[model samples]
Target chain A: MVTYIWVFFVIVGSFFTIFTGNVEALNNEILKGGADGLKLLSEMLPLLVLWTGIMQVAEDSKILELFSNLVRPFLCKLFPSLPKNHPALGYIASNICANALGLGSAATPFGLKAMECLQEDNPCKDTATEAMITFLVLNTGGVTIVPTTVIALRLMHGSANPSEIIITSILATLCSNVSGLIYDYFKRRKKHG
Target chain B: MANFLVPIFVLGIILYAFKQKVNIYESFLVGAKDGLVTTFKIAPAVIAMVFATNIFLNSHFLDFVFSYFTPFLEAVGIPNSILPMAMVRPISGTASLAIMSNIFELYGPDSFVGRLASNLQGCTDTTIYVLALYFSSIKVTKTKHALSAGLFADFVGIVAAFIITFLFFG
Candidate 1:
């Protein structure tokens, strides 16, 4: 899917630029894009390192487990197919908590771990299960409360009220999450009904 | 208030770790090392995405596409510069962030467009990227309804971001 999108971008972008007589700008972007990518990577590197390190403390100290226990009952209601004490639930809980706090780098590890656990019990190795689909929906909806990265960028740009959008972001993401879950629930019901 | 949230959260994690009798320094180093490996692993994807998105943006196709909606957008109070950001947001986070930053630079962050960009950025994750990565990690080729649900969520998020921003800051 992403393959098609990437190709579309490259082909259509080039054609459009040529047709629009912006071949010069196209040339510049193509020449500079790789460097831009690297620069972006560098900027993200330190933050990822620091947050993952802190998150590791959260994991090793069993804080994640405690957090998971706190959220497990609610999560079990969402992912009913899973066992009551599945390890995947713990990972999923940690992932969601990290994501809500806007620690995306930290969330990826737990997310991958959650997938690994889910794959262990998956009936079809090549197909996603209903629980997996539900998890993906919740994950993609991104119930972020802080949006730390956006605020950081706003601060970098010297915004007078860098964090002003936090409440609005939370509200918007809540709407996304609720609607996505509702859609997923109905689809799941239709599939296995 | 929001500015203090992250610092307080980080401190709480650290304090909790200490209370748990965890070796905070060693654990951090281990996780940080893993983070480095993960960064290297995802760098190729990030680079590829950035290269493609940069070309797409440089082509000004979004401007051409959005030109038709300029009058309507103006009437609705949506900035013309934000159309691409909202559209590309669920496809790529880095690309969206770049656009948000551009909006901030063009119109100060307090500006309505800047607030909209920030709300848009926080409204959803990169659906395609997350789906691709998570599914491939487990070798799941048949994604079923995950894509549709995720994209649906993104659509809702985008609309919600716009409406919420207008209500709050417009």
Candidate 2:
């Protein structure tokens, strides 16, 4: 509810600014920005295909399963309702894997599949399940090591050292993931308690 | 070179393990098929999001917001170059990528703002798009709480990115 309100304000605010002609420079900005965006996307294709192929190989070889097993103990602690071998675990692993590589497009299927698998065990038709809540937390704060997408954008923009942001990216993701996990923990505790 | 070699070695080991047991090519093809299907399913929403971002940006509204939020952003250690990104981050990844590229072009990659903007781009997401698509696909009718929670997470991401960048690059 409050979120919608904030969005409404943001929209109205942006429009108000536009109406005041405060953004007349945007015409040229968009023209330049769009071209650059397309170029970046083009350059990103090879990397995206490479990572997608690697992820496919990972899935085919059950390396994803292996990864899931490694994370299962911690995930189980976070999401008690999810059974030991729930399909959502695989989807979650894939989603996390794609995200770590900074492949947001590639992460979508895995996220959707994870949610679907979670829905299987959701007793309440309307309320989000514990698994769903936890998955949301993980998705929102998923660790991103390479941040390939951003690096690609940097490369497109002619950044000399596109990879320099790797350390900061990792740190920020770690913080977000930790905070998300902590928030979920207390939220769940409060709900049950 | 070592950075590039590591990933190749990892892939090679995985392939070697699967040799003679499973048809690696066939399995990969199957997975690719699934990937293509998922891509198509989400294409419409992604396109709509891209279009919306284009409109918002072209309308010049984002610039105004950036100006308005300049002081607050600076207070948080975010440079002006990264401000456009902060505005676009919640709108569309593609649009944000475009903005990022422009920044990189105007200011070389090593420039503080360019680097920070690029990093922040990776760290955050198109929160509105994610909320709409994820909730809709799952038939989530009332998105009140989810929206609030997701945006709150995005806010944290923005602040975290600024702080991390400042600490590491400042």
Candidate 3:
């Protein structure tokens, strides 16, 4: 599935570029894309390092255990396959909290940690576990109520009502997250049956 | 308000850890070291995705396809200016953001199109990038239904954004 998406991008993009006589643009993007990726990684590096470090303190102090236990019931419902006491549950809760606060960069480290923890118990080592899929769905489909960047961009552009779309955005994300969770639920149910 | 959240959250965690007698500095260093390792592990996946998405965007494929829908979309009161942002939203966050900024430049951010862009930006995430990075970091090649489910959420989010934006701001 991932391979198909990448192939579609490269193939169709090149296919169109060849016909449009825009090969130079494509060539330039191809050459510069790696650097851009590095730039993005660097932009995110500080947040990842800082939060993971801070969260690690939480982990070691049993603070993480307390936090996870607070949300464990809610998480258990969302991730039925994971054990109640799994360490991944702690990271997962932390990831969801960061994501909800609209700190996407802060969320990635926790999500990665959760994935690593999940992988520890994964039977196949190569395939994704059910809990991982559900976590990804929640991460990708989760609420971003603040949309701090979007609001900031709107304000930068001198919008009179920069935050007016907040309600609408929240509604839309709720739709997405609910629908994604429903789809994930049915997918899990079918597999079990 | 949001600015305070980050520092407060960090400070609160440290205080909590200190109260619990955890060696904050060592714990942080250990985790930060793993953070470095995680970053390098996901670097290849990020580069691969950025290359593909950049090439695709540079080729103007979505723009070309969207041009044909512009008139039809406008006829139905949809702003064609936002089509690029919507289509690119799930593929690349930077691209979608660039497109949103462009929309703000062209149509003014308070315009219907701009508000819609804001809503769209907040509606869904970069599914492909998120999936690739998370899965690849853990070396999970067989992602099963993760991609499909994420994309489905993106699709629904896009539709919901359009509907909610029009109803509220249109």
Judging by DockQ, tell me the better candidate of 2 and 3.
3
Q: TM for chain B in all models?
A: 0.70, 0.69, 0.96
Candidates, DockQ: 0.60, 0.32, 0.78
Instruction: Between candidates 1 and 2, name the one with more favorable TM-score.
Output: 1
What lDDT would each prediction earn against the true structure? 0.85, 0.65, 0.88
Better of 1 and 3 by TM-score: 3
Q: After superposition, how far is residue B90 of candidate 1 from its true place, in Å?
A: 1.5
* TM-score of the first chain in candidate 3 relative to the native first chain: 0.95
In candidate 2, stretches whose alpha carbon ends up further than 4 angstroms from where it belongs are: A1-63, A156-160, B1-44, B70-81
Q: Write the per-residue lDDT of candidate 1 for residues A1-193, one digit (tens) a residue.
A: 5566679888989999999998788889889889988997798678768776887887898877787889989999999899888878878987897789897766776776688789999988988998899999999999898899999999999999888898999999999999999999999999888
Model 1 alpha-carbon miss at residue B104, Å:
3.7
Worst 10 residues of 1 chain A by lDDT: A104-113
TM-score list, all predictions: 0.82, 0.74, 0.97
What is the C-alpha lDDT profile of model 3 across B1-170, one tens digit per residue? 88898889888889998888888899999989888888888888888888888788888889888999988998987677688888899888888999999999999998888888898899988888889889889888898889889889989999999888778877
Best by DockQ: 3
Candidate 2 lDDT at B134 equals 60
- DockQ-based class of model 3: medium
Which candidate, 1 or 3, has the higher lDDT?
Answer: 3
Model 1: runs farther than 4 Å from truth?
A23-60, A153-162, B1-43, B105-107, B137-139
**CA displacement after TM-score superposition, residue A101 of candidate 1 (Å):** 2.1
List, residue by residue over B1-170, the lDDT tens digit for candidate 2: 32464476457636753863656766666656655554445444444444345555556556766788778868976556577777677666766777778777787677777767766776766767666556555655554245555556666777888787777777
